[model samples]
Target: MTRIAVRHLGPPRLTAGLDGAARLDWDAHRRVHPEPRPLTAARLVALAEEGRLHGRGGAAFPFARKARAVLDAARRRGRPVVVVNGTEGEPGSAKDKVLLCRAPHLVLDGATLAATALGATEIVLGVTDETAAESMERALAERGLDGRARVVRLPERFITGESGALIRGINGRRPVPPGRKVRASTKGVGGMPTLLSNAETYAQLAVLAGLGPRRYGSVGTPGEPGTVLLTVTGSARFPAVVETPAGAPLGHLLDLCGTRAGEGVLVGGYHGAWIPGDAAVGTRLSREGLAAVGGTLGAGIVMPLGRGTCPLGECARVVRYLAAESAGQCGPCRLGLPDLAGALAALAEGRDAAAACETVRRSARMAERRGACAHPDGTARFVLSALEVFAADAARHVDGGGCGRPVLGVLPADTDARLRLEVDWSRCDGHGLCADVLRGLVRMDEYGYPVIPGEPVPARLEDDARRAVARCPGLALRLVPRAQRGS
Candidate 1:
C-alpha cells in the first residue's frame, strides 16, 4: 500500500524528516536515538514527570503513573516485561500502524529502552495489520533482537488492544477482557509485571529520552509537551496521518489536511466526542486543549462530518458498529448497546424521532460504567456527543422526516453488515424453541415464529445461538452471515 501523507502543522517530532511512504531503517532510527543513555528507574520516572508524557492511545492516560506502577510492582515482585501495543484496532486511527510501519525502529528503540531500564526479560510487539506485522518483524531482525525480542500477531477486533485483553492474548488466552479488572502493572504476562503501552506512547518516550525534559518540554503547552500523531480523515483534500505540536490550533491542522468542516468535526475516534465546527477553529489538539473544549483527543482520530450527508444517519451507522464490536461480556454489551443503537436508528429513520432521542439518552446512561471494557462507555459517549452537537438537525429530523440527505458513509468501518439470525421458512413450522434457547437475543413475534435481532449476536450468546440452532426440530432456524443478509 502507498504510504499516507505525513504532514506537519508546527514543529514535527514524530514525523520529522519523513515524507510520504518512507520507512525509517535502523540507521535512521539511531539518529533519532543516538547513543541513548540508559535510564535508571528513578531517572526515567523523573523524566516522565517533567515531560508529563501521556499515552497516545485514546485515553491520554499519564505514562508516568503506568511506568511507576510497573516499577513498584517489579520491585516487590520481579522485573517487568515490556509490551509495545502495535495492535491498532480502531478503524479511524492509523497513527500506531503508521509508526509501526514507517518508523518501526523508533518504536523498537523505545521498547528496548524501557525493557533495559526495567530489566525486563521479554519484549513483545503485538501487531494486527499484516503490513505492521511485517515491518515490526523486519525492525526486530535488523536490531538483532530476533533472539531476544518477539513479535506476535493479534486479532483485529476493536477491544482486543485493551491493556487487559492485550496481556491476556500475550499469555496464550483469548484476547478479551477477563470480565474483571486485570491490572497489567502488577499481574500481567505469566503473572509478572508488564509495562504495556501504545506504540506511539513508547515512541514518545524514546523522543523524551533522547531530547531530555527541557528540550522535550520546549514545544506545546506546559501540561502536555511535544507533538501528537493524528489520523485525520474525512472531508479533506487528502486523508493522512499528521504530526503537530500539542497546543497547535486544531483548525490549522484541519486546514493543512484541506478539510472542510461541513457539519461539526468528530474529534478522536468512534469512541470520542464531537466538537462544533466553530469551537474547533482555535481548539488545541492536546488532551487539555480538547478537554477544555468538551472534546477528546482519543486515539488521535479527527474526522469532520462534512455536508452533503445526513449526520444522524452517519452517527446511527457508527453506533450500530460500536454495539456490534462490544466484547459481549457485560450487561451493557448484551442489552443496553443494542437498545441504544436501535433508538439511534429509530431517530435516524424518523420513527417516533422525538421519543427516540430520549430513548437514546436513557440507553446511554444505562450502558455507562457497566462493561468489561470501555466499549460501552465509549459508544455511549459517542452517541451522546452526537445528540448534543446535532440538536438542530435532530429537531428537524424529528419534527419533519429526515433532513432529506443520504448517509454517504463519511466515517470508515470494518463492516456495514449487521449480524442477523435467520430461519429457513420452507424447512418446518414456527418453533418457539429458539426463543426459549436465547432469551435476550431471540423472541417470539405475533405468531409462534421466533423473532431474532438483525444486529450482531452478542459474543456471550454464541452458546445460546448454537443451542437454538442444534435444538431446532426441523433445522429451520439458522445464523445467517452478513454476506447473505440483503440489508
Candidate 2:
C-alpha cells in the first residue's frame, strides 16, 4: 500500500506536529496531544452533546445520540464492543488512514475512553489496509494495551466501511451491509450491542475529551464545533490530508493545495455531490454549511477539477467506478447504477446526447432510496448533482458531441481495473431466472443463455442477484470480485 502524506492547517487538533513525520509513537503522541481526560458514559455523551460533535464519517450523525443508544443497548443486552472503524473505503478519502497510521495512539485513546465509559474492555480496531493494521497493532503494543485492543484486517471493499458492514465483517461474515435493517448497536458482533465509529470519530472524541466542550467549540462553526480532516486530492499540487477548521471557505482549502478550482469541485467522495468551483469558493466546509450550498462535506473529501481534464469524462469515469463498486444487493441499485453509468458514459463520449441525459435522469430517479444501504442514494446524488452543476458542459454534450476535451482521468479508476462479473456458459441452462431477477443487468441472448453485462455487476444488486444465481437451474451466474482483464 502507498503511504499517504499528512498535513494540517490552523492549530491541528488530531494531526498536530504529526505532519511530515511517518508515525508517532505513544510517547511522541502524548508529547504533542494531551492525554484524554477520563469521562463516564454519561459524561462523554454530555460533552459530545454540549460540543455538538458530529461523526466525522459521511453520515454526520450526532455522536452523542449514537453513543447514548449504544450505552442503553449495552446495558440491556451485554457489555458493548467498541469498534474503531479504520476501514476507509472512500477512494478519495485518506484522513482515516492518516490517523490510523500517524496518530494510532490518539485514536486508541478515544476508543478506550468510549469503551471504559460503556464498561466494555475489548477494543476491536478494524482496518482495511494491512499497513494500517500493523500500525495500530504496534501502537497498542507500545502502549501496553495490545491485549485489550485487537486489530482486525478487514476486506477493502467500498461498502465494508459502513458501520453495519464493519461489524458484520468483524463477526466473520462477508463485508457487506445486512439485507434487512439490523442495527449494529442493538445486535452486533457476538450478538452484543456494538459501539462502532470510524477512526476519525474516535480521534475527534479524544480531542473533545482532552479540550473539553467549551475549548473544543472554540474553532469551528457554532453548529459543528472543532476541526475536520479532509483528504484534499485531484488537480491539487500536494494532495495531502489537511486538518482544517469546520466552515472554512472552499477557496482557502483550494489555495492550500495549490489547486485552482477549474470546472468545479467534487466535495465528499464519489458518493458526494459536485458543485460549481466559483460558487463553491464561498461555500462552508461544514455539513450544514455545505448543505446550504446544496452539497455535503461527506467524508471531508474535496477534489478540484482543473480545466485540463474534461468534466464530462471525469464524471463518467467516476460514475462507472461507483457502478462497479455497488454491493450488488437490490434490484434498483444493480440495474439503476449501471444504467446511469452508461448514460453518463454515453454523454461523455458524445453519443445519444438527449437520450443519454434522459436515461441518466430516469435512472437516478429509479436508483435513489431503493437500496438497503445508502450506496444507491449517494451515487444517484453524485450523478444528478453533476448534471445540475455542470449544466453548461452537460448541455454541450447533449447538443453536440462534447466540449472537445480529452479524459485526463484525474479521478482514480484503479479499482475499476481490478474485478468484474462473468458467466459460466456451460452451466447456464437458459432458465432465465437471472435475467428476470436482474433484468437491469442480465438479459437473455439469442440462444437463451443469460447475457451478463461485460462490465462488472453493480454491487447494489449483489444480494438479489446472488439469489437469482442460486435459483439458476444450472448454477451459471457468478459475480467476479477482482478484475480478470484490463479495464
Candidate 3:
C-alpha cells in the first residue's frame, strides 16, 4: 500500500507552505490514468452515467443526477455556480482534510473540470479549518486556476456545512438555515443556481474525467467502484488515513487499526450508529453494505471502542455534547435535545436508566423532522443507536448503582467541561418568572428549576431569553455559553 505524507495539525491535517502554487503528491494513488485530460459537460455526463458515481459525503446522492440538476437549472436561467463542500464538520471524520493536505491538486482538478462542464463561471471551495482552506487556495494557484476558482472559509459548527447553510453563509448571512426548507440547486449563493457536493466527490470527478469510467471502476466493488480515503482512528496501531477499495471489509479495517477482537466498532462519526464485534460480519464498508446491516458508512469514520473505558458513560457524555451543539432554530430540536441530554446524564448518574431510555425515544421523535436542519435527526439516530447497542450497560446502570469504569472522554465535548445551568436548590424561589419571560428558552420543571432547551437561542429571541435570565427572582438562572463551561 502507498502512503501519502501528511502533517497532523491537531484534529485536522494541514499542508505546509501554501503561500504559493505547489504540486500535489499523486504518484501513488492517482484516481485517473493516462495523464488526466479536461472533460466537457457532455463527456462528463456520459462518464458519470457509465461509472454510476455517487456523492462520497455521506448523502450518497448520485453524482450524475446532481450534475444534471445544475446543468438543467443553469440552462433554464443562466450560469450556475459549483460549490465544493470541504468544511467536513462531522467531528470524527477527517478524510477531506487528508485529501486537501496531501493531494490538493486532485481536488482542484476535479472542481475546475466540473465548473467547466456545468458552465459555472464561479467556483467556491468551502472549507472550515484555516489549514484546509489555505491548502486548497495554494493548490488553485499552483494550477494557475486562481481566476476560475475561489476558496471561502466555512463556519466550524456541525450544521454550518449543510448545503443550504453554506450557501447562506456565502451570501453574508449567519451560517444557519432559514426556518423554511430551501434547495440550493434552485436558488443558492447570491440567488444563482448552484451545484454543491463533497470535496472528495469533486476529486473523484476529476479522476473520472481523466481516466474514464471503465478504468476507474477497476478498483472497488461493482456497485461502488473506486478508492475511498478513510480516517481510521481509535485503538488502531496507526491512526491515520488509509486509501482502500470502497467495499473493503470492516474487519480488515479493524485489524489494521489494531483493535482487539470483540470490541465494539463505531462505523460512522457522532451521527452514525454503533455495531457489534463480530468480525465475520464486517464484509464490506459501502453505504449499501452498511445499510443492509441497519448501519451507515457516514463519512467513512470508523472508531473502535477499546476496553477499560465505561462505554455507557462515554456515550452519555457524547450525547450531552451533541445536544449542546444544536443550532436551536426550531421548536422540536430546541425543546427536545437538552431534555434527552438530561436523561442521558441521569443514566450516567445511576438514576432512572429505563425512564431515561424512554425519554430518549420520545425526544428523538419530537426532534426528528421539526428542525430546519437534519442535526436533530442525526443526533437522535446516534443516541437511539447507542441505547440499542449498549442494552447490557443500560440494564446494569438501572439495576445497579452505575457503570464501574470512569468516563474516558473519548468523544469530544462542546465545552472543555460540563455545560449546564446549576440551580442552587436551596436558593430557588418558585417565582415562575423565568418560565413566563422565556417560554421557549426556559421551562419550569416539577421542582421549579428551569429545564433549559438544548438549542441556541435564535437571534430574534436572544433578548427575551436574556430578560428571563435577568428577571430570576432568586438570581437562580445563568446562561452559560459552551466556551465558558470549560468542558
Among the numbered candidates, top TM-score falls to 1
Predict model 1's lDDT versus the native.
0.83
lDDT measured at residue 377 in model 1 versus the true structure, 0 to 100 = 87
Q: Give the TM-score of candidate 3.
A: 0.84
TM-score of each: 0.90, 0.88, 0.84
Worst 10 residues of 1 by lDDT: 412-421
Q: What's the distance in Å from true for residue 450, model 2?
A: 14
Question: Candidates sorted by lDDT, descending order?
Answer: 1, 2, 3
Ranking of all predicted structures according to TM-score, beginning with the best and ending with the worst: 1, 2, 3
Residue-level lDDT of model 3, residues 320-406, one tens digit each, is 666656676677556677677767776766765778667767877777877887778788888787777777877888888587878
CA lDDT of each candidate? 0.83, 0.82, 0.70
Clash count, predicted structure 1? 1
Winner on TM-score between 1 and 2 is: 1
Model 1 residue 100 lDDT score: 91
What's the residue-level lDDT of 165 in candidate 3? 84
- The C-alpha stretches of model 1 lying farther than 4 A from their native spots are 31-33, 416-487
